[model samples]
Target chain A: MISTASAVIGSRVSVGHRMLALTWLISPLLLLATWALVAASGHYSAQLLIPPADVWHTFKDLLHSGELLEGAAFSLRRLASGFVLGASGGLLFGAALALSKTVEVYCAPMFHVLRQVPSIALIPMFILVFGVEETFKVLLVTKAVFFPVALATSEGIKAIPRSHFEVARLYRLPRYSLLLDVVFPAAAPPILTGLRVGLTRAWMVLVAAELLAADSGLGQMIEMGRQMMRIDVVMVGVITIGLIGFVLDSSLRLLERRLFRWKAIKE
Target chain B: MNASLDQRWLASTSHSPGALQIRELSKHYLLDGQPMEVLKGIDLRVKPGEFVSIVGASGCGKSSLLRLIAGLESDYSGDMQLDGKAITTTSLERGIVFQDHRLFPWKTVAQNIAIALKRSPLTRQEKALRVAEHIRLVNLQGFENAYPHQLSGGMAQRAAIARALITQPKLLLLDEPFGALDALTRISMQRELQRIWVQHRSTMIMVTHDVEEALYLGDRVIVMDARPGRIKYEIDVDLPHPRERHAPRLQELKEILLTELAGSDADK
Candidate 1:
């Protein structure tokens, strides 16, 4: 009984230790501490650098007013639609480039050159062609997502060993079975990584697009706050953007782990 | 009279199914803008349920020969036939296990085996049963749910064997199936493979560098010379299944093979 009690205590202590070791949760707390200390030191004017408490109050006010939530929801919808379009196109195009030598020969060189142009750089041209509307912002996010995903997908397909194809041939697997069972799974780790990278890039580009021209979104909120001299509100928007990007990336990483659990065992 | 009848029955049965006949088999590849011959003027005939081992040094095109037989490489001047049908492309009737187990790392042992049954007309339940049966044949009953990465090298190769055999191919080709294993594991796996072959009695052709392995498992060991690879000689083991490893005949054949290999290296 005494040993069992000690074992329970030991288990509780380890659980607490694990919580402490979660640096992602702890990092923001550390940043908050530093901000509070700097605010108390009075090194700068309050107008120049708002305290964490003031930022918190601004965040609560935005929440209660529902503008922040509405902006976030609208931003997420655009991101989802753009990401889906861009990623699907990327997947098909990438698989084509990998599978067909003729397609690769014609398009690969041009693709390499075109993908070098940043989405932000193309924003002006997109605005001219698409107008400064939802199309422009959505296209910007799509452009951001397409290049990375395509490159990753193509590389992943290329990296598959010839032996895999031989095995498929030996088994005489149907074309659909080859694609679903062999090609997809063999190339998935890199493709999933590509999706994660594309997601974060999409989020970043969407924010940048909103900042430049959007009538709504967290980025627009930040811009409006800046114009109104509400630094605390801008800070809240910035923090929210970072948090959302972090959440998106972490969830993708979680999914990757779950799907490619075999990789972890091999390592 | 009964023994004679049994002998005739066995001969007819062995000659009837899975007979691979290769004639004037030659393969060429372009190297540095020059055509290089890999396999030259080869002729081999493998009877049904016979285990033929081909041994050669590296670069001897032993692997290429296996690939040609497996129909992975078709650019060859050869008349290759299986059970009187021309072998032009990969077929479910021919199964191959590479030097590496080549078990799809993403799949569990059972899934890897089941994937080979995709083209089979067997029902789902029958396929599952066959997969389980083959898994048991390879002594991997408890590892059905385990992924390839989770298995040891020997176990993974066994799983590959199971996968290859699950289709119940008329002929099975193994390209150095135990080449990647440790010495002890290789010995044990060779024994397991012999046992499996005894049980299945399907035509199997294995390519390996190990002379003892070739002699121990093969009904006939074909020794090939490098540089325009061709059969230099063939040694008939004339031994039965579960043969003693230290048999004088095997030891003598191993010495002859080693000398032949070393002599060719000297000639080079």
Candidate 2:
């Protein structure tokens, strides 16, 4: 069996198992080097052209003052509440749409139309209805998460091969057992991918919503930095946001690999 | 070993391997509002512990016939029964393997085979033991943890066969179970299937386009014709288990079957 696997997925294990390659750092280093060169070249004013070192100093100050942690915690808390509720709701709704002809016929067109309207465009109405507080930000995040996750779940369930259901019937698997043993496993890959996509998109929307109006968040910190003319503080917020988003997405991708290791088996 | 439980399973399996009886079985489908007949008034009988093979050209509905027996479809008008029980919905007594090895991709080989026992009366320990036993039966001991895609085509098919049989079903249906294989793998799997049949002695019915495969494994071969499918010929192999592949008798029968099949093809 190992031989057969090796024959199909030859030598990829070596490349795939590494956590990080030295080559991955080169691009980031190059970007930083270019930024430093520009800062030293002295084209822009000191305010506009603060060096990477100044951003690092700002990063340290935020870290030491606990502002960064507080802001990050607040942002993440909102994401968690919104994502959990939205994703679970989407999962249930998507499953219903996939499993029931009634749901598909009645709800699919409206779902398609609603998902097309971007969450950012709904902010003014959302502000009026839900107010420019935590409710507004979380709802925007939930909206961002719901549509893609539901779409993915519905399509994923529909994509499961009919023959699998036949086999389930042949063995007379009970309804719940059929769902657990066959249906869920087949649809899991796509559903997980949808979650990753939703979470990242929600993060983007939540940040934008915070920038528009929020008491405390990473996005609000960036907004404050702009008002205070602290370019270094703005850079700190920007870098943290980018790094956090990358970490969230990368971690989910890793989780997907770990969960679906069997998928590596070639057909 | 649980001697009494093992004895019960053996007795239930060998003493009364299900007998399949079919009569006036015909199936049709509505193709864009037109009723298209796929099988026409077919009749077949499979005795207990019998290995029956059905062969036909495309559109012969040999597969549909097997699916009907497996109770995968119910729209057909017919008398179909296993051991005097009228077939209605899918039953655990009738297990099927398709041309594709339908081992769940997410499952390991052991897990795949074990799923067949989800509704079995066996205790968890007995189910595990039986799964291991079937793994051995299919010569897949070392591959038990391997996923389907990790297996070679032949290995995957053997795993599928193991899954089909682990239920201790009265009748196992194979719809071109080896049609996806290369020549070498096909021959080896046929030998493996024959050996398993000799050991388990459960009733099996296989459908294949390969006349040689049908003749090699089957105690009796039923040739079918296409376009409103009907059984055209039945040839009994008057041979024993572990029949020699290169035997003069098999070769002779193959010649006759091929000539009849060629004649039917010429008419097309």
Task: Count clashing residue pairs per candidate.
Answer: 0, 0
Give per-residue CA lDDT, model 2, range A238-259, as digits (tens).
8999999999999999999888
Of candidate 2 chain A, the 10-residue stretch with the lowest lDDT total is: A13-22
Clashes of 1: 0
**Which ranges in model 1 have alpha carbons more than 4 Å from their true place?**
A1-30, A40-43, A264-267, B1-16
What TM-scores do the predictions have? 0.91, 0.92
* Among all candidates shown, the one with the greatest DockQ: 2
Judged by whole-model lDDT over C-alpha atoms, candidate 1 comes out at 0.88
Q: Report the lDDT tens digits of candidate 1 across residue range A140-256.
A: 888888888898889999999998998899898999998889888999999999999899999998998888888998889989999999999899999999989999999999999
> Candidate 2: which docking quality band?
medium
Q: Under CAPRI classification, how is model 1 graded?
A: medium
Tell me the TM-score of model 1.
Answer: 0.91
**By summed lDDT, which 10 consecutive residues of candidate 2 chain B come out lowest?**
B8-17
lDDT, candidate 1, B213-244, per-residue tens? 99999999998988899999888899888789
Candidate 1's DockQ: 0.69
